[model samples]
Target: MTHKIAILGASGYTGAELVRLIATHPEMEIVALAAERKAGMEMRDVFPHLRHLDLPTLVKIGEIDFSTVDLCFCALPHKTSQEVISALPADLKIVDLSADFRLRDPEAYETWYGNPHSAIEMQKEAVYGLTEFYRDQIKNARLVAGTGCNAATGQFALRPLIEADVIDLDEIIMDLKCGVSGAGRALKENLLHAELAEGYHAYAVGGTHRHLGEFDQEFSAIAGREVKIQFTPHLLPTNRGILATCYVKGDAQVIHKAFENAYADEPFIELLPLGQAPSTKHIRGSNFCHIGVVADRIEGRTIVVAALDNLTKGSSGQALQNANLMLGVEETTGLMLAPLFP
Candidate 1:
């Protein structure tokens, strides 16, 4: 019953996370690990913490035998993901952890990513990979596109509100803070230990963050009209998790009730009591999302906060969740790992 899996871009943080999660999975096994630049190297040498697990040496994407891979997790960077995925076996099951296929419209993809999408046909067929809401779609999908960690965090806070019309959609504002690991393992001047240790600054201000494409697509589709949210993201000094605080015009108690009704049966979504909020530490290294609601002094204002590990629930864990569904396994199988508490 073991599903043979291949991980492209295995040297990256998300890719390594896939390896860590699969190492213990009863129904899935890592058969090939691909890293373009790190090809010909041992996976354990690329990620020391994973030295205990015996894994295949890193190879280039071109070197993987897709016919033997039950599913492939693409953790490559943006433009590269589309080019590589387009060249992959068209019938291969793929769970993409990149931004390439998340946006449906080729024009929208180019607008946000600054390049024309090279795989529009596949983009049209890829299902959005928010496991809680897209369960049915993912179970039948050959390709699933993982959402932005920030986008996933914010949506977990607000989607129910919008669906039930409990909040004023036009006044929605999401102020999110993300761990440095969400930036990926790429070398950057701002990500240097010296530069990031005490630094907390907002980037992609004024709706420039590409995840807006997701927020707009999902929210608008649900509301049956154009819905735009004010979203601003900040960089945290830490290495994991995302905290998204949403400010909205709504009846506080009713919105809390909405979350209760929406996630009452969802395995990974946790609803905290009124006046409480979640911390990123509580959900780190796990596929759980904790949401809390607080009422503002103003009669019609409510603040909803959500927390999850950027590397787990936000990306790689999400990919694995979709893969399980695609493989006809239980939705929560191989993903019941407890959150790492400090």
Candidate 2:
């Protein structure tokens, strides 16, 4: 029962990651790969790290025959994903790794992304792709929307406490540090070696980062009320991880207990010891999220920190996990690789 998989935007970082993970997948095979500008080039040529993989030559999205592809992973840019996905076969299953279909409301999408969504019907139909929380929904979904790397890391830190009512909703603050790879492979003046090699700095401050929409939407839905959280993200000098430190008003022990209970059965979520903290180095290049909780020096203040590879657990790895569920395959297949440690 091998499922035929297709990848769009194959030249991008996330798309190449999907190809890397699926190359070892037991029940999945790459049938076709599409890239707008990289079409006619071999994947191994575009990404030399993938030279060992015998993947198909990249083609334009319109050139591939979707009927032969059991599932497609769209790793294109935001607005581009909506347009491309809208034109895909109506019944073809899809896992979109862009900001396009994540926000359910067209107005909310416009507010966050500054563009009205082109696929309203598909947007409403797409399930959120946070695999642990949205497993059941993803298994039956025709389309799945992958979460923002920052959003996913923050949610992992706060979702349990929010669900348990153990934290002060109004006082929540998430300060995250992410590796530059989360920015995609696109060239940018800020991402140059000279600029990013020596230091790191915060970019999205004061809730201006778009992922806040997800935090607001998901956190609000879980608490059954409007929950506005202060989120600030920093870009680190490294290449592939996200470390989020969350501040909240709560009992540290109680928060630990809540996290333990919630993530006990979740395979990819690793809850650390009480008063301990996690570093992105431990979970790099894997589909595992390490969480730690410690009490702040101030009374009633607790800190929760979470770490995961932004491209793995945060994006491509998550897309594969959802695809497994949607295809009725074992959810953890080809995704149980251990985190790379130094």
Clashing pairs in 1: none
lDDT of each: 0.94, 0.94
Evaluate model 2: give its TM-score: 0.99
Question: What tens-digit string does per-residue lDDT give for candidate 2 at 34-93?
Answer: 998999999989999999999899999999999999999999988899999999899999
TM-score (all chains, Cα) for each model: 0.99, 0.99
List clashing residue pairs in candidate 2. Answer: none
lDDT of 1 at 128: 97
Which ten-residue region of model 1 has the weakest summed lDDT? Answer: 327-336
Alpha-carbon deviation at 197 in model 1, angstroms: 0.8
- Model 2, residue 123: what's the lDDT? 82
